[model samples]
Target: MGILNVTPDSFSDGGRYTDVDAAIEHGMDLYRAGADIVDIGGESTRPGAARVDAATEVSRVVPVISGLAAAGVPMSIDTTRAAVASAALAAGASVINDVSGGLADPAMAGVARDAGCPWILMHWRGHSRDMAQLAVYRDVVAEVCTELLARVENATAGGVDPGQIILDPGLGFAKTAEHNWALSRRLDVLVDLGFPVLFGASLKTYLGRLLAGPDGTPRPVDRRADATLATSVLAVAAGAWGVRVHDVAATVDALAVWRATGSPRLAKP
Candidate 1:
């Protein structure tokens, strides 16, 4: 999956493609580069960010969804609001990638159930504004797994078919650097939950911190593509069903090489 964030405050690549034309061109480019799906997000989920109104959120992504859909590229809307998800799907989004995992809105699960589209439910504690306060965990991996499973149950009970659902651990949503690392190290646990797992760790600050630049300062999120690619391939090796990313071309190329060669798709160290 290729990530296309239209919000001006996303931690990475914000303001780079807020225009509909530019965003659509970028989505098409991702399709050409080897992304199986392009995910469009109108809100910035960077920690402590303020929420955008549903109207503005819809405005940011509907046209992109429409253009991508018309171009025959699969598209997913990265939103937590039921209103935005419904609008985007009506406008031609095929998947609902909700980072909140049905916690923010009681109507989201029903919406997905009615639409019958593939729903990507991520493990989240609260909205971006207050999620950090909810990140405390006794066992980050086990707790995340359990919470995600509960979300799957909620979606199922709400009428979303078990087969049409996917799970995401939400690498940077509210996790500390160590928590993210632990989740990345044990992605196989998520895969064992009987649903497709989506890993969305592209260009996150955690990777930047891990792979500091030569100046001894943490690398910027925009400069973490190589590290992101490494994590993508590792996620695949750990049995992740898909990887969400900003630079789809690089990920696709790396995956192609792994698939073409006799090596494992994820080639974990």
Candidate 2:
């Protein structure tokens, strides 16, 4: 999967694709560069980012989604609003990647159920504005697993088909670097839950912080591609069903190497 953030403040690559034409071009570029799916998000979900009204978000993403869909690019609607999801689906989006996990909008599950498309329920404690404070957890992996399971149950009860549900551990949302690492190490736990796990660790802040300078300043987003590729290949080795990424070509190459090797381990013991 490739990420297409059509918002003005999405931590990285925000204003880069806000224009409808530009967003469509980028989505096409991602597809040409070997992306299986392009995740187009209208609102910025960065920490402390303010929310956009549903109408505004819908306007921002619909034209781009429509254009991409017209061009035969598979797309996923990255949103928390049911209205926006519905509009995007109408515009030809095939999947709904809800960061809120049906917690923010009660109408989301209904939209997914009605569409019968895949709904990605990311493990989220709250919205971006207050999610940092909600990162607290006694056992991060266990708590995330429990919460995601609850989301699955709730979504099913709300009419979404069990087979259409995809789980995302939500690497950066409401999670500290340590929490992200813990979840990465225990992805097996999530994989064993009988749901497809979507890993979205591409060019995120945690990778930047982990590859910081000697003075402890985090690396810039452009410099995080290498780290993203590492995480992408490792996630595949660890049994992730798919990885949402920004640099699809590099990851595709890495996965090619991983497949050619026929051994997941890059180093011999």
For all predictions, the C-alpha RMSD in Å is 1.8, 1.9
Instruction: Kindly list the per-residue Cα lDDT of model 2 for residues 43-88, writing each as its tens digit.
Output: 9999899999999999999999999999999999999999999999
Would you give me the overall lDDT of model 1? 0.90
Candidate 1: tens digits of C-alpha lDDT, residues 1-269? 99899889988878988989999999999899989999999999999999989999999999889988999989999999999999999999989999999888889998899999999999999888887778788999899999999998888989889999999999887899999999998888778888999998898888888888688789987689999999998888788999999898899889887777766544434
What local distance difference test score does each model get? 0.90, 0.92
Over 4 Å off, model 1: 213-216, 264-269
Q: Once model 1 is optimally superposed onto the true structure by TM-score, how far is the C-alpha of residue 38 displaced, in angstroms?
A: 0.5
Q: Clashing residue pairs, candidate 2?
A: none
